[model samples]
Target chain A: MSTIGEYIASHAEMLEAALIQSLPPQWNVPVSLRESMNYSLMAGGKRLRPILVLAAAEALGGSQAAALPAALAIEMVHTYSLVHDDLPAMDNDDYRRGKLTNHKVYGEAMAILAGDALLTHAFYSITQCHKVHGIPAERVLSITEELAAYAGARGMVGGQAADMLGEQGLTKLEELEYIHLHKTSDLIVFSLRAGAHIAGATTAQLAALTDFGNAIGLAFQIQDDILDIIGDEKKLGKPVKSDEKQQKVTYPYFIGLEASELKVKELTEQAKKALLQGGFANPERLLQLADYLMQRDH
Target chain B: MSTIGEYIASHAEMLEAALIQSLPPQWNVPVSLRESMNYSLMAGGKRLRPILVLAAAEALGGSQAAALPAALAIEMVHTYSLVHDDLPAMDNDDYRRGKLTNHKVYGEAMAILAGDALLTHAFYSITQCHKVHGIPAERVLSITEELAAYAGARGMVGGQAADMLGEQGLTKLEELEYIHLHKTSDLIVFSLRAGAHIAGATTAQLAALTDFGNAIGLAFQIQDDILDIIGDEKKLGKPVKSDEKQQKVTYPYFIGLEASELKVKELTEQAKKALLQGGFANPERLLQLADYLMQRDH
Candidate 1:
C-alpha cells in the first residue's frame, strides 16, 4: 500500500479531476449562475473534506470508486457553505482561497442561487452513487440521512447559527465548544463516518472512526484559531487576526494560545490512536494529514 | 373511494400537519434560525407539490403512507426554492403566500442558510421512508437519485438559472418556452411522476403519468402568466403587475394574453385526456386541481 501522504495526494488529485469534470457545461446554466458556481467550487483549496472521505473509505477496505461520489458530495456541500458565507449578509469576505469570492465575482443574487444549486446537487450526487456500486439502496439512504442530519440545522447549520450569535460573546468554554463541535466538527465527522458507512464498516468500526474524526475535527479547528493569530497574512492567503477584529469567540481567545496548541497535539495523538485501534492498515496518510493540518503555515 | 378532491384536501392537511410536526424544535436551533425556517414553511399557501405526490401515488394504486416521505421531500425542495428566491441577491421579493419572505424576516444570511438546511433535510426525509417501508434498498437508492436529478440544476435549478437570465430578455419564443418548461414545469412534472415511480407503476402507466404531468405543468405556468396580467392583487395575495413592472418575461409577454389563455385551456384538456388514457380512476381530484389552478384568485 502507498504511504498515507501519497494516498491522499493521489486521491485528492483524482477527486479534483472528478469535480472539474462533473460541473455542468457552461451551456447548462445561465452564464452568470454558472460563472458563480465554477468560481467558488474550482477555487484552489486543499480539498480536505473530499480527502477525508477517500481516506476513510479506503481504511474500511472499500474501493475508491465506491467512495468517489461521497467525496464529491462533501466537497459540494463545503463549497456551497463557503459561497453562502461569502454573501454580503454573512461573513462578507471578498476573497477566499486567494481569489474573489462567489458573490464578489457573480453578484449576490447569482451567488445565492449558485450556492443553492450546489447544495441541491450534492444530494443528487450522493444518490447517484448506487449506480456505480450495486450497494443496497438502504445503505445509500442511510448515508443520505446521516449527511443531512450532520449538515443541517441540527448539526453544521445549527453550529453556524450559534457561531454567528456567539460572535458577540461566549461566556463559557462549553458554549464555545458546542459551537465548534456543531459548526465545524459535525460535517468533518459526517464525512468520515459517511465514507465508512458506504463502505459497510461494522458498527464498532464506525464508532471508532467517529471518535477519530471528532478528535481531528476539533484539533483542526484549534489549529485554525492558532493560525489566525500567528500565521503570515500572505501565507494564509486571507486576512489574519480577522477573528480578533470581529471579536469572534475562538479556542485561543478563551483557552489561550499555549493551551489551545496543547489541545491540538493531544487530539491529534488521540485520533491516531483510534485509527490504530480500528486496525487501519494504511495509517501513514492520516498521520501525515494530522501533522500537515497542525504544522502548516496556511 | 374518496373523491379525488376530498382525498387531496385530507392528504394535504395530513402532510401539512406532518410538516409542522417535523420542524426542528426551538431547542435545536438558535431562536432566529429556527424562526426563519418555520416562518416560510408554515406560511399559508396551497401545498401543491406534496399533494401532487400523494395524488400520483394514489393514482397508481399505492397507499398514501407508502408515499408520505416522498411527499414531504417534494415540499421541502419547494420551500427551499422559495426561500432562496426571496433573497436580496435573487428575486428580492418581500412577500410570498401573503407573508413576509424568508430573507425579509431573517435577514439574507440566515435565510440563505435556512434554505440550504431545508434542501439538505429533504434527502434525509426521503431516506427515512426506506426505514419505514422496508422497501428494497436498491429501489430507495434509485428513488433518491431520481428525486435529486429533478430537484437539482439539471432540472429545477437549471430551469431557474434560465428564468433569471431570461427575465433580462428572452430573444425568441422558443427560448422563453424552454425557460418556463424547465424552471416551472420540471419540478411539477417530477412531483407527479415521483410518487408513481415509488409505487412501482407499470412502464406504460409511468409514461402516461409523465405526459399528464408535462401538459399540466406547462398549462399551470401559462395560467400563472395570464393571472399576472388579469388577476386581482387582493385575491392573489401578491402584487399582480409585479412581473410587468420588473420587465420579467412571461408567456403572456411573448405570446400575448389571449394566446396564452388559449394555450392554457388547450393544455388543461390535454392533461385530462392523458389521465384518462392512463386509466386513472378517481381522477376527479386531479380535474378539480386543474380547475382550481386555472381559476384560483390567488
Candidate 2:
C-alpha cells in the first residue's frame, strides 16, 4: 500500500507539472508579468492545501482530475496571500520557503501586480475544471464562488486586517481566535468542502469534513506557533521567533506552551473524531494526514 | 424622448443604489476593510462599465433585474482596479473622480487590502446572480470565468505590466496599442460580453458586441489621451499632463492632434457599424452612448 507520504509526494509532483503548463505560453503577451507570477507560484513548498483537496476528494470518491483546477486555484490564492503578506507594509519578510521573496526578486511593484494576477487567474483556473474532467459548468461555478468567498474580505482578508490592527494593540484571546478562525481555518475548511463538493459529497458529509478541516487547521496553526518559538532554523527553513519579535499574539504566547501543546493534541483528536463520525467509505488516509500535520515542524 | 445623457444619468443612479446595498452589513468582519472598499466604490464617476452591461443585456432582451448581480460585479471589479491602479507603486495618483483616492484617504496597506477584498468579493457576488434573476448557475459560471480571464494576467494585468515597463523607455506605437488594448479594452469588451451572456445573446450577437465594444473601448481611450493633453483638469477631476509628466506615450503624442481626432471619429463609426450589421433591435441608445463616450470630457 502506498504510504500517505508517497501519496502526498505523488500528488504534489502532479500538481507541479500541471501548474507549469498553466503558465502563459511563450508566445503570450507581457512575458515579464507571467514570469513574475511564476516566480512565486512555482516556489517550492509543501502544497498542503492542494494535497488536502485531493485527499478529501479521494476519500469521498470524487474525480481527482475534476478537482485539479480547484486544487491549483487554492494554491494560487495561498501563494498570492503569502506574497502580499510578506510586503514591507505587511510582515516585511525578505524570504519565503527559504528563498528571497518575490518583491525581493522582482521589486515591490511587480510583486504587488504578481499577487493581483495570481488572484485573478484563480477564477480562470476554475473554468478549466469542467473541461479537464467533463464536470458541469454549474458545479464549477459553485466552486468558483466558494473559493472567492473564503479567500475574500469577509474571510481571509478580513482576518488579515484584524491581525494587522491587533499588532498595534493588546489582543484578547477571543479576538485572536476570531482571527485564526477566519485567517486560517476558513480556507482550510473551504479546501475540504471544495474537494467533497467536487465529488458530490452529501451535505452532511461536507459539513463533517468542514468541521474536521476546521479542527485540523486550528491545530496546524497552533503547531506553527510552537515551532516559531522552538523550531531549529534549518528544519523550519526560516527564522524562528519572528512572531515574538513582532510582538504578535500567538497560541504559545496567549496561553502557556504546555497548554498550547495540549490544545494541539485536543484539536487533533477532535479532527479524527469528526472524520470517523463522518462515516466515509474509507477515511484512514485522511486520519493519518491529520496526525502528520499535527506533528510537522516546518 | 430621453436623450443619451438622461439615459446615462438614470442608469448611473440605479447602479449607485445597488452598489451601496452590496457593501458589507453591519455585523460583517473587518469593518475597516469594508470602509476602505466603500470609500472608493462610492466615489463618484460615470458608472460607464456597469451601464454598458445593463444596456447590452437590455438590447439582447435580458432582464435588468436578472442582470443586477453581474452589473454590480463588473462595477466592483472596475472600482477595485482603479483603487489598485492608483496606488503608489502603480499610477500613484492622489485623487480620482475629483476626490481623494483610496490610498490617500486610507493608508497604502488598507488600499491594497480593499482592492484585494473587492476583487475576491466579486466572485461571491456572482454566486448571487442566479438568485437575483433566475439566471442559471452554468451561465453565471461562464460569466465568472470570462471576467477572471479578461481581468487577469493575459489581459488587464498584462497590459498594466506593459504600461509600467513602457514608462522606462520610449515606446513604439504598436507597444502602446498593445497596452491600451489589454489594459482598457479587454475589460470593457468583457463587460459587454458578460451582459449579452446574461441575456443569452446568440453567438453572432456576442461576437458583434465584442467587436463593437472593442471599437468603442479603443476610441474611448484615444479620447482620454486627447483629454489628458488639452482638457481642463477641473472637469476631468484629476491632474492633466500627468501622463506627459510621467513621460507616457499616447495617441496624440504618436499621431498629430487632428489625426487622433479623426481616429476617434473613425472608431466610433466602426462601433455603430458593428451594432447595425449585427441586427441589434433598438440599437439607438447604444449608438448614442457610443457617441457620448467619444465626446465626453470626463
Interface RMSD of 2: 1.5
Candidate 1: which pairs clash? A4-A285, A109-B89, A137-B137, A137-B138, A138-B137, B236-B298
For model 2, state the Cα shift of residue B213 in Å: 0.9
TM-score, cand. 2: 0.98
* Model 2 score (lDDT): 0.85
Please give, for residues B27-77, the per-residue lDDT of candidate 2 as tens digits: 366878888988888998898988888888888777877887888888888
Q: What lDDT does the true structure give each of the candidates?
A: 0.79, 0.85
Query: Model 2, residue A19: what's the lDDT?
Result: 83
Against the correct fold, how does model 1 do in TM-score?
A: 0.95
DockQ of each: 0.68, 0.77
Candidate 2 chain A: worst 10 consecutive residues by lDDT?
A: A20-29
Chain B TM-score per candidate, please. 0.93, 0.97
